[model samples]
Target: MAITSDDVRHLAELSNLSVTEEEIEPLKKDLGAIVEYISQLDELNTEGVEPTYQCFEMENVWREDEITEFEAKRKDLLNLAPESTDNQIKVPKVL
Candidate 1:
């Protein structure tokens, strides 16, 4: 695939990049080479081959969700607070 200057300019615009007039020719050549290289994958024989999504063996280890009682009681926590009103902690009023 041959990448033209116009293609490079369009790609630059889509990518929100500022490409100089001198950089366009080099970018076109580089991009053309990259596309050609990637196109070589079409020549591979992938028949009956399962697409491997992950290279490493992975699994989701799940456990039953249980609510355990906290060691500190509500009264204990309220006592530790700087200021408490009724059964809740009190903070400075905000606008």
Candidate 2:
């Protein structure tokens, strides 16, 4: 499971990363260590253990859906915005 320079190069190419020659050795060592650690995990003795998605036990704390009394006009909500366009809040273009 040890990672070689060629393996690192191939992975970098697939990921579109430009790994310099100086960085290849460190990356190879790091990747090799990770692979070795994961390989060791494969030797576990959890024959009857149940597969769990989370580490801790969890239960849904959902509340019962019920209509709640609330009073607020549309104009009151719109007045909080710094700028509005055609009864809609204006936001800056991100993309």
- Which candidate has the top score in lDDT? 1
**TM-score of every candidate:** 0.49, 0.46
Cα lDDT of model 2 by residue, 57-76, tens digit: 67776888998866987887
Clashes of each: 0, 0
Best by TM-score: 1
Q: Residue by residue across 9-61, what tens digits does model 1's lDDT show? A: 99999999999999998999899999999999999999999998878777676
lDDT of 1: 0.93
Report the backbone clash tally of model 2. Answer: 0
lDDT of 2: 0.90
Show the lowest summed lDDT stretch of 10 residues, model 2. 52-61
